[model samples]
Target: MSDTESNSSNRQTGIATALQHPQPFEESTIFDEYREIMTRSHEQQRQIYSEFKAFTDDVASWVKAASQFDNFRSRKRIKTRLEWIKAKHGEIEGVRREVVTCVEAVRAALSMLGGITRSLKGFSGIVKDEFDGGNDSDLQEPRSVDCAGPNQACAK
Candidate 1:
């Protein structure tokens, strides 16, 4: 067979295979799976928040200790310590912003999913209510950030 004919034959075979073995999850099942994934993500975020909090606390303690020393050695140590503290503070800030962004994204996604669910359920009042006074200002705008600059680590 020619190259074009061979390519068409392969495409037809692929389509036939895909049709024979359809996706296992229905629309509702897919939504449930997504919700489960989000739940796990939330748990991971909580752990990250705790870890970062502890790290920030440790940095704060070091800063406090560095403040009490007056010797030349302490002065030298303080310089490096301050730099470390500053870096950590930046990391903390980045994580904070990331958490905020993730929360907003999740909220938006949930809102969309809620709409889909309502539509699927044949609820007519939801759309009207959403437009009337049920809308939240916080969900209206998503916060954005630039993590490509120097010293900017994109928080996962």
Candidate 2:
């Protein structure tokens, strides 16, 4: 055999051997990094939820305390003040509800991402198994095709 043919055969043998004993997949750093980022995001969300809850509680308490001032003011003045306070309280409650909704949405999205990551990991194993099932002959050598006619293209 010629030197080039001998070298090609050796290379193919090496590839076949390598394919027969594939390396085990290690946990990717990207997975760990994303997991860490998600954890930090969850922590931040919790902190924001706690702070918002505290602020809303304080607003509710202040509104309750202000209700006591009705005794000091004239009946007409007290009625007007109470109406304004009630409007403000309603606005605050609306904002509080929106915050809670936003937090819940974030949690749901994180759960979805976690599920997708797990599914991808499972799919990777199936792909690895398919490759390991003695399908390495295609990697041994390139196939030749005739392109003799006019307008024919030779693909590498």
Candidate 3:
């Protein structure tokens, strides 16, 4: 056979082997742990969002009520209390700080979740392609086909 024909035959054989033995998706213990952490982070984000919304809504209601009231002294007192100092003897400042931290954490979790989702999307077709009209046995051993020997496939 010519060199061109030999290369074509090798390519065809490698492709057939790869199609016949696609690997199944296997979730490791570490992956399960990360998934659990992500689930908890998602739930915490919801709770923090609710708490932050409620805090803001309460402040808005106070401002609205203070404005509508006919008593000037009461309005002043309410507005004065809204202005907070971290050094003062009050827990509102600390709570606000914690809310900010929670929001930051939520953003971080969202980034991690996006990466995991992308990875899962890439693997989404693997299981279907592995099992569709093939792999007759339930416990087929995983097989890998190397089209190129060692690192010869790399251009570098």
Estimate, for each residue in 1-156, the C-alpha lDDT of model 2 and write its tens digit: 999999999999999999999987768877999899999999999999999999999999988878866654677787899999999999999999997787677656755533222222321232111112134555444343334444656443
The Cα error of candidate 3 at residue 88, in Å, is 47
59-149 in candidate 3: lDDT tens per residue? 9999988877857877788777766443464687788788778766765675543322222232123211111223446535533322344
Ranking by TM-score: 1, 2, 3
lDDT of each: 0.70, 0.68, 0.64
How does model 2 fare in lDDT? 0.68
For TM-score, candidate 1 versus 3, the one ahead is: 1
TM-score of each: 0.36, 0.30, 0.28
Clashes of each: 0, 0, 0
lDDT of candidate 3 vs native? 0.64
Deviation in angstroms for 109 in model 3? Answer: 99
Candidate 3, residue 57: Cα displacement in angstroms equals: 0.7
- In model 1, the Cα lDDT at residue 64 comes to 79
Deviation from native of the Cα of residue 72 in model 1, angstroms = 11
The best candidate in terms of lDDT: 1
